[model samples]
Target: MLKFENVSKVYEDGFKAVDSVDFEILEGELLVLIGPSGSGKSTTMKMINRMIPHTDGKILIDGEDITKLNAAELRRNIGYVIQQIGLFPHYTIEKNIAIVPELKGWDKKKIKARVSELMEMVGLDPKTYAHRFPKELSGGQQQRVGVARALASNPRVILMDEPFSALDPITKEQLQGELISLHQKLNKTIVFVTHDMDEALKLGDRIAIMKDGSLLQLDTPEKLLHEPAHGFVEDFIGKHRIMQNPDLMPVTDVMNDKPLTSLPKRSPERALSIMRKRQVNTLVIVDENDVLLGIMPAYDLIAKMKEITKIEEIMYPPEPFLSASATAKDAILVMDDAPHGIIPIVDENKKVIGVVTRGSLLSALSTLWIETEESE
Candidate 1:
């Protein structure tokens, strides 16, 4: 848990790198700070570890003022990763990862076990790569070694400053996925710095957008996309609109809560009456708890009125549905290939809560374009 209260940073030359920015990083949450060059994202991350002293305000970690703590002792407990990786060239991978543990006066046996465990944790084979020098590894491999070194001491907080910016796109994506998986497993509080909006959206639990050395907006990716705080926020997001990642937008934000429905045990005549009243040809059959049972079409009900008495007897199985947490893009893809006109949205218990149709998808797309135009 880290809190920045009215934090500001200014150089002796009168240049303000960060201007009274305030935010909190919750325990086990990955918070991303993103902005263009010189927007103070890197400076803000540096302030956490005291790499750059702030001009005013306070930074508290776990309820203690960092300014009162010894800088060296404080840094040892905080893992720091940078773009250049900064691994010693002469040191072997094993030695590199053991730097922090060795400094803390850990036993040789403990340090060796920690080195091997970390190498394996970051996807490097300990037996094969532990003894090798940093020069023997590729850029991506070196970056992974940097990450292993960061976690070598088992720190509670990790500050990553554009750590993956130098890697190729494919490797960057792979490392991002690895970091996400690692975060979920380790539950370490992380402060990530990036200029890439796509990276921020894909990885951050919440994103903090900065501009001109000031915090602009901070929110989840879904809220940030649908409801930008200002024109600058809208324009910044609009630049990446062409490559909008659907995973950032949940289906619940776009789903229709009201859908035509009928009781599973209802008479065919009653089902038909409900469908006609709603002006829909299809009816979803559900139990009292709204658990999806099947579907009934008006045509089928009308044709089988004389043959079947209950809707359940004439109802057919509904098409595949998605959970409420699924992304809007996933719904669009499912709807594009679906045989039925509507897709049911369900909860964890498989209770139908909403519906997504072609019309809804079109409306969402139209809104997106309209926002883009307004931003431009």
Candidate 2:
């Protein structure tokens, strides 16, 4: 747990990067700090690990004032990752990841084991990537090494400043997925800084939107989207709130209308063909009436090749179907647990109307933001 009390920061040049921001982060919660550049989001994060000292007020970690702790020791207990990744160019990925543990005076065997464990934890195969240098790895791969290094010492808290910003959108999403999965397992208290509203909404347990070096609002993504504190907050969120909320809108209203490739009865070969062709992970399962049946995920199909021969064999019931009349928020929740990135939308008659994929929702959100910005 972490707490900031009346925290503020003013550079010697007299620019305030943060202003009396106060908040508490619970254990295992992910708190997102989001705002435009120079909004003090980064300054706020730095104070947690004492990377930047607070100009005023006090910061406490687990009830102890962080200012009282030695900076090096305090930071050792906190994991930090940044957009630049900051891995040593000359060091192999394993060596880079082992830096923290080594600094902590861990023995060679223990440090190596931890490095291997962390590499795997972040989805990088230790056997393949451990000995590779930073320059040899892709941006996303380097970022994973950064993450692995941060956790090398088993820190209870993690600080991330736009950790995914340097990568392509596809890679960024992949890392975000990995981060979410890692959080669910590790449950470390996380403070993340970003300018991306969508990322904040997806990963944050609560979001702190800042402006002019001051805290604007701190609340759940739903609350922040549904009830912005002021015009600035509204403008910041743009008009994407509607698409982010799936409960009020139906899938038909936002679902992709293009004819989708479907598999008659799920077969590993058929599912693989469709997925490979569409570059998708999901296949809609329907009966003669094109009625909603279930969904077969590409991963599941591949993992259970023999069973996939029968649509019913590989088909797992959808999390729960949403009606066309349902809100977009409902759709979001439905898709949250969907592995295939698809959610089924049904008619009142319980017949399948269509499906909403992640791409559709994101596109709708972008358009909504542009439309709202233009209106302004």
Candidate 3:
């Protein structure tokens, strides 16, 4: 967890990069900072690892003031990914990722194993790229290496400063998708800085909009889209945005349209691999045409992992599901019955189209209550 209390950054020239910022980043949450050029979004993120030390107020990591901690050690414990790939060209891909752990004095075997695991997680085959230099890989591949290197030490907090801005559209989209899946699986606290509003909406659990170095509004994506606290926030999000009453909003408005799924015929090992790669605890089972079959919670699959071969044999019936016509109210009512805190949204034909996660449903209901209180 990270907390900022009246934080600000002022240089010798009297220019304030960040001014009186206050927000707490929850553990395992991905918070995005977005604003126009010179908005201090980047500065806000840099202050997390003391990359840009704050001039005033306190920045705490799990209650420990960052200024009191050693800057070098703090940085090594926090992952950082920048727009430009920062891998050392002379060092092999494996060595590049192993840098942090090596600096921490990890055993050779442990570092090697961790590097290989991370490479696979980022979609780079360690067997092929481990010994290869950064120059040999393409831009996207190099960027993947950069991500792997940042995640090498398995840091709990990751600071990504417009990391995908430099990539081509196709690769950028791909990396964003991967990052989303990775976040779901790993649940690392991430503070991502992006100039793109669309990127912030898609990636952030909660977004903080900054302007002229001051924190504007910090809220969930739905909260920002539905209720912009400041005129600048509204203008930044665009006037064309739909202004829906949270009480009447359908589950579709807030649900994750892209839910991770798996086939029923996979072996426990194969199924487990998919879950780990996707970074999900529950896997929705679907047929070839993607019709809902059953639900496989990670615990159930693991318990039966050695005993059974096929996951289909142990998958439970997909109950407590949300129909396509379901509203946010319906989701809230049935959430407690969800086996793994996941309610799959199925169409009339029984095809899984999306999912209303516990967190999303709770946020919607909370927003509804808050609005009701203000109206009353």
Q: State the lDDT at 332 in candidate 3.
A: 73
- Candidate 2 residue lDDT tens string, 301-342: 778887446757757776677776676666666777876788
Q: Tens-digit lDDT track for model 3 on 1-376? A: 7999999999999999888998899999999999999999998999999888899999999999999999999999999999987889899999999999999999999998999999999999989989999999988899899988889999999999899999899999899999999999999999899998878877989999999999999998777876889999988986333323333356786587888888888899998898899888889999998899989999988887889978999999898887777667678778888878989998999999988888777675666566656654
What stretches of model 2 exceed 4 Å from their correct place? 244-376
lDDT of 1: 0.89
For all candidates, what are the clash counts?
A: 0, 19, 1
**Candidate 1 weakest ten by summed lDDT:** 238-247
**Predicted structure with the largest TM-score when compared to the true one:** 1
Q: Could you tell me the lDDT of residue 208 within candidate 3?
A: 94
Worst 10 residues of 3 by lDDT: 239-248
Query: Model 1 over residues 1-376: C-alpha lDDT tens digits?
Result: 7999999999999999999998899999999999989899999999999999999999999889999999999999999899999999999999999999999999999999999998999999999999999999999999999999999899999999999999999999999999999999999999999998889988999999999899999998877887899788877876445336666677876778998887877888777877888888878888899998887778778988999778899777877688988888888788866566678889999999988888877787678677767766
Superposition error at 149 for model 2 (Å)? 0.6
Candidate 3 or 2, higher lDDT: 3
TM-score of 2: 0.69
Residue pairs in collision within model 3: 185-279
Per-residue lDDT of 318 in model 1: 75
